[model samples]
Target: MKEFLSFIKKEFRHIFRDRRTILIVLVMPIVQIILFGFAVSTEVHDARVDVVGDLADPSVRQTVARIDQNPYLHVTAVLGSVAEVAERFRAGKSDVAVCFERNFDERLRHYDKAFIRILGDGSDPNTAQMIVNYVNGVLSTVQSELSASEGTQTASFPHVQYMYNPAVRSSYNFVPGVMGLILMLVCSMMTAISIVREKESGTLELLLVSPIRPVGVIVSKAIPYLALSLINLVTILLLARFVLGVPLRGSLFLLAVMSVLFILASLGIGLLISVVSATQKTALLISGMGLTMPTMIFSGIIFPCESMPVILQYVSDIIPAKWYIIMVKKIMIEGVGFSYIYPEFIILLVMTLFLLVVSVRLFKRRL
Candidate 1:
């Protein structure tokens, strides 16, 4: 009994002595719980809604007011014409557009029915549906209030329309997210592990003493992974388009260019991970825990960042996958051109440059 107790005490001491392992075991659960509890939600909030109709009409104005007042929706613009709805959506300014038909009040009084069209950006089908549901709920409440005052039923409802993805297919939403995930997994994890393996095998030291520059070595190692990532990108695109029935609505050339930029950004992240990691196992662990988890959770891939807490939303801003996913959706589903997605492009460009410079500097110091 004494010997067994001593062995148990030694095991506890060993565990407590390793701070990294202790930190992982203790901190990981707390962080994940906080993130999942506070940062992930299915509910929509502050979704940009565009209202197009005669604000002068009492009924139309009332309904718009109700929608604006709803906690989940925000009336970002009140447009003069229905035609502007499409223009706003194309410009990525609106998530949901509420267009009241002409003579909305008269139709409600005479025919007991008035039509309002609700247009949603269906690139993210789940969010689009939620926005429409919230709008409908507000309209329903307003209808009830107006009907009660008039002592009759007011048959006024929105005719919902979804652009880009008319059917609101889940596949449309998942493909881009999956693309981002696969790229990060392949580019970051593989590159980091590969570099670490070379170091473990002592080949890195041999290469360092040779004539090749450190930057060149890193680039050469990254090029193969970059090429593989491109191939994987093509495969995912083909699968999304042909196998999954997700349409490629925009310029394929533009999609390719943006995808290439994203690939470079991912490779840069991998290089940075490689520079920091001392062993293959360490590289794999960091790439998995640091890169994969954040990419999957906080990048607006599975959850809408708008619904997240303010702090998590801000943290998501630094995630490269977030920008890549946005770019993909805007280009492939929204059919927008470079002008609309330039901000995402600029962010990715800056991240790639920053990671590359840091990795190169670190690698040189190590050599």
Candidate 2:
């Protein structure tokens, strides 16, 4: 008991003296949290739409207004002719175009069923399908409003055509999500083991004998791992870009910034693990059981959260990796901005602070 007390006291002394390690411990987790929170997400929103119709026609103008008002749709350009619409869709400047035949109101009055033709660029099937869904929803809403006064009448739909990804590739959803899971495992567990290895080897004591502090030793260990993690991040991103061919619709700068946050968050967790376990093997086992298993089950990477048993869904709330996976999927796949991701960010921040506080309290108790 006396020896354990003495060793813990020595650990505190080392921690206070090593300013570099302390800084890294404090800073690294935030970087990791930001990365996981902002760089990833699964859902897509605010897709660009093109409207090709006579702005002067009242019925066409009203339809355009409805499209513009929708939160999921953003009108990037308006076309005057079929030639212009075809050119934009073929150039990939637009995902879907709304074209109204000449004298749209006149035709509706005479035929009681004029169609607003929708043409979609089907280069990416999922995106093309999403575009059709959006247009269908818009047309439904417009017809629903028009039908309220007619008692009970079936409304005809404006024709919607899908261009590409007639079958949305399952790979489009799986590939990016897999990258998030892989990084979380490799970066966090690897760092945790490295720290615990120092404890298992006698060098941790030698470092204590030096002027360096416990925190400094931990930080130095973390720094090299963080670098390696970043290299892995770059490699994974490039593979997703060049090899898998995922589009980077969002800003790369923002992605880099968020990645660093998640890395730091993971490092803090690794340090906390080191402080708990006396042996490297114990640390590895605990880290795996604590982080990896739960993360895989709850992170919604493999299984959808909605489909999970109610209890399991609630259990997922505590898993940090679950939140990270959600955030990454939204940012990378959906191309949403920070405002859309703030709730996930706040949750991750809370988890990080909770972990830090717990580790600090534990360190003090052992001391």
Candidate 3:
């Protein structure tokens, strides 16, 4: 019995001596719980909206004020012309636009048929629908106030028109999300495991000493996964279009370009993980537990990030999948081109560069 106890103590000491294993075993669960618990939500908050109408009119002004005051919506811009509403959406400045016809107060008072137009960007059909519902609720409250003042029930409310996805298809939302998830799985998980397998077999040292530059070696290793991810992208698009009946309204060329960029970023993450992991099993565990779950939870793939607790929402900004999903939705469903998605593109580029730099430095230290 004493001999067995001594063996157990030695085993535990050996396991605890490896810092990478200790970090993975002890730290990963707590981090994942905090991230998944706090950063995931289904409700919307602070959704960006633009108002276009005569600001001088008392009713129009009141309605805009009410919308601005609502916690769920933020009135970010006031446009001078109704024509600018589309421009606002195309520029990605707003998620929804409220346009009031000229002399809206007078029309409501006399004709009892004033028209308030609610235009929503339906790239995220669910969010677009929710925004419209919130807008309608605000309009209803304003109409009630007007009716109470006039001592009549003759106030007309706004009519909503959803652009890009009038039908509010769920597939439109899921396609981009699925695309992001699959690419993350392929580029991050697969690449990390592959590289760590080489390390486990003791061949990584040989390759490191070879003629190829370290950066070149890493890039070459990633090329196959990059190509595989692109193939998966096309396959998912085809399935989304034909099987799920989701529309690909944007430029396919632009989608392909952005997808490649996202794949590169994912590869960078995998390479960094491989640099830190001592074994292929450790690499797989870290990639799955740390990368995969967070990508699904915090990326706004299944839940709206705005609804998450404020701190978690801030944490989600670091997730590459979040930006990639947003870019894909904008390009595929909103039909916006590179100009509208440049900010996300730049962010992804920065993240990719950071990951690659860290991975390269760490890998050199390992040598």
Q: Which candidate is the best by TM-score?
A: 1
TM-score of 2: 0.54
Give the least accurate 10-residue stretch of model 2, judged by summed lDDT.
Answer: 162-171
Runs in model 1 deviating more than 4 A are: 1-153, 365-367
TM-score ranking, best first: 1, 3, 2
lDDT of 2 by residue, 1-367 (tens): 4544454555545444667544443344335434443354333467778887788887788778898888778788888777887788777778788888888867765666667888877777657777778777887787766556444364555544433223343444555555555556655666666656666777666666766555555556556666656766776666666655665666676677667666667767776787878887888788779877777678776567888999989999887777766666667767778888889888888887776566545542122
Which runs in model 3 stand beyond 4 Å of their true positions?
1-158, 365-367
Candidate with the larger TM-score of 2 and 3? 3
lDDT of 1 by residue, 189-241 (tens): 77677678778888888878866667767767676666666767776777677
RMSD of 3: 15.1
Cα RMSDs, all models = 15.2, 13.0, 15.1
Among all windows of 10 consecutive residues in model 1, the one with the lowest summed lDDT is 29-38
How large an RMSD does model 2 have? 13.0
lDDT of each: 0.78, 0.67, 0.78
Where does the lowest 10-residue lDDT sum fall in candidate 3? 29-38
